[model samples]
Target chain A: MDVTNRIERALTEALSQADLAGCPPRLAAAMRSAVFPRGARVRPRLCHSVAAACGDDNPATEAAGAALELMHCASLVHDDLPCFDGADIRRGRPSVHKAFGEPLAVLTGDALIVLAFQTIARVNCAPDRLLKLTQVIGSAVGVPLGIVAGQAWECESEINLAHYHRSKTGALFVAATAAGAASAGADPEPWRMVGEKIGEAYQVADDLRDAAADEDEIGKPVGQDVAHDRPSAVREMGIDGAVYHLKSLVRGAVEAMPPCSNGNELRSLIMSEATRLVPAKLAQSAA
Target chain B: MDVTNRIERALTEALSQADLAGCPPRLAAAMRSAVFPRGARVRPRLCHSVAAACGDDNPATEAAGAALELMHCASLVHDDLPCFDGADIRRGRPSVHKAFGEPLAVLTGDALIVLAFQTIARVNCAPDRLLKLTQVIGSAVGVPLGIVAGQAWECESEINLAHYHRSKTGALFVAATAAGAASAGADPEPWRMVGEKIGEAYQVADDLRDAAADEDEIGKPVGQDVAHDRPSAVREMGIDGAVYHLKSLVRGAVEAMPPCSNGNELRSLIMSEATRLVPAKLAQSAA
Candidate 1:
């Protein structure tokens, strides 16, 4: 099956579990709204690619990829809350909070996080591998350096750009590679660099889009970094410098891929993603 | 070590992991404040008692208990948020949202939930047993019949008392008993009834206290059910009827315990807890 189908199917199965007979209908609806009409599916695709490159497409790997995407979706749901970004539109539709109300939105995000871990736990796999995957994925969404800490950085008076970006955007990407490798019973450590570089590149691309892309092009409001006064590559390094840095990170990601049985396919995936990351006008100008 | 000390130490270790370098100081502080100055620690005690009855003092069991406590704390933190209960105090102090603003409180709850799963994943245990424990614990916090569903029920226009009580309170109790058994490599199924009854009894007791006990006795606001027009045993059944129900449920819990070597010890613990559940004035009045 194709990567998108695998991720979508796994996600559907996982959400179905949460959408049991007794679940509150609104909460279930909100969770679905947050996830469906997918945006990019970058994290899960990376996870699946890494697992495939490791030469194993285990059911556990598919579940792990789905779990990563759910976590991403959960983060986005919470991120759009009034307390945070207060974004009204996501994936070109009303965001979870805007559509579901704040209370259900909060519950939806919480339910999704729980569902993410539950998805991994429900998958039948080697116990050791499941444990490792759970740890890697849990750490990506957790504290000290996880997405939670990344969000908390916004509240702090002083912020470190690298730490903020790493925790906010890079943690899940790191989890994607590591969990994919772990799901395949391989050493996940070697794959972390690839995730980190790709994650960094993605953030830079996001910063560039926020700075230069049209609102219609990104499907969400652009210039949010400026509006929110958030630290970003474009803000710190000028547009040209940020674009140059983004290209370097993409190259670094490709070079960092651990040699595996299906290395070429994975390499091509990363290169193609790089082309899509930068907005077309910026890509042309950089070229 | 005694059960209290064991729970405390495990929680300390878990929190320390989250309080790593580079974590936003306020976020870490908020997380700690949500957890420390602990409440009665009833859930962990129940979990430990069950583990002991099942003849296993495994580290995984301890971790499971701690994870349960963390989940409880996380729920309380979120429950007290402006969008939810909007209470200002918990455990005789300002609640997480009141103490550190709403944004930090949200992140703190999110972080704690992640920490709970991470704690269980980090523990060393038999792979199969760990897997079972993870599923049991994860289900207790997620949707359909978990605490999140319990909270979601409040959002719905209509609410079923049994479903609300089961998801909100009984689910974790069920998890405590089941996870304890699973951690000891025992079948978790037979332990469910004991948890269910105990959880129901506790909720009744809470209703009784809220209706009759003083604010000082509970260390937080009382009469919230009336204030919020929430469904409660006190409102549905009256104080005398609720007290009668509480006693019956406590008796049911004792009778439902699965036979094990340390059965008498667990029985005694349950009896003692029942005594503590009812406020002194209510107990005297009922008698």
Candidate 2:
């Protein structure tokens, strides 16, 4: 199997094991209903992309890939909690809190976050590389920047999109880019700019879908951002403008990506992903 | 200052700087409340003890000390959520969720977890050492073992006290012990066993209190464990036997502590901590 598919398969195995083994029965039952028709697995894809970009290897790519995805999953669970988004629906099912009790939902999210770090640490990478990856990912998850800030936006009026997106959404992507490169035992600095730019594009596209996509198209509430007055590229810049910026970012990211067998394809995939938000193929029946 | 007082002082300083600039308003507010009457600063005490034993430099000892305590605080916030302990009170005040509402409570807990890792990663230790510290701490927060398991236990049945205490309560203590040793850059394995044993003793004392103590003594609900039918040391061993086991483990922990300048004192402290849990205190209070 190609690297992307291989990682997805591995992730499914790992996630299922996590779900089955440590999960409380109520939680396991809830997750069973919530994880289907999953989103694009965008973060995992990025991890695998970076891993392969760096010449796929053992300790680095596998650990980084699993760690990033686990973090992403944890974020989703928390975001769907009644407190933050109060999102009752996720991936087209009742959210974690709605299905499991709110407390278990909270603990499950906590578990996932810890699992992300555990996945990374268990990798056989040199202690130093594992250490670097842990810091990078940890910084993304915590303070001034991390997912915590992203959720905190709901309570505030003024928003700094740059900082918000950077830590809240972009941090993990940056980690994926860096982690993948590091997995190859190579310094991943060159990929940093690329990761940042791609993350920007990704967030913008998310805004587009949020503003215009319907439930059928997006598989979740649309215009929820405007409804909540949360941050979004469309709110900052109109939808058309957001698309233009996404294209610009895609171009920048493509240029920043290192030369590799998958580099060009990765660039194209990212570009297409940027436009995937259009309520287009997703609303096929409407079309 | 003695290690405990100094580390507690240091922890206060650390919490002040968190989110000082551009912090999410809700996050800042909740974080502010979460730090009040912060628990015993037990993790910092353990970290400092390990560092003192290993001869931690001024910088290493201070950084690891602050980081470990933050993790403990974060875990406590999550644990107190209505979903986990449904604990309306902690350290004699309304728990984080009770004070802030569920959403902010979730965000604050997430932020603290991230902050714990960020603080350690940003600390001045060699990147390798910093990485080691964060990874160890991160493991203590998540998965097959950790706080998540502690929370997950509520959802699973046939409650296993050994595993529950190990993950929810012991992991951080274990991390604190390992972190203490790591400050001096020692091999962490030797200290792990000592921390684990001490952590178990701590849990046993907790069980004894929960089964027999009154609200004024522990400052929280008494007998909640028995109410929940949760397996506990008291349930497992009965009162007198539990006390004896706690003392025996303390002796083992003292003997096992990494040898250092403060070894004798740490042994004494551990013994005293266990001793204070004497059934006499509960009996006197009841009388």
Identify the leading candidate in terms of TM-score.
1
lDDT at residue B49 of model 1 (Cα atoms): 88
TM-score of each: 0.98, 0.85
CAPRI level of candidate 1: high
The most accurate candidate by DockQ is 1
Per-prediction TM-score, chain B alone:
0.98, 0.91
- CA shift at B106, candidate 2, in angstroms? 0.6
How would you class the docking of model 2?
medium
Measured with C-alpha atoms, the lDDT of residue A175 in candidate 1 is 94
The docking quality of candidate 1, as DockQ, is: 0.81
Off by over 4 Å in 1: none
**Residue A87 Cα positional deviation in candidate 1, in Å, after optimal superposition:** 1.1
Q: Estimate, for each residue in A1-287, the C-alpha lDDT of model 2 and write its tens digit.
A: 77656566555655563454543455445443434345577776776676666666565676677667767777888888766678887777677888776777777777667666666666655777776777767766766666667667666667766677886778777877877777776687777787788788778877878887778766678788878767678888886677677778888888887766557556667767665645574333221
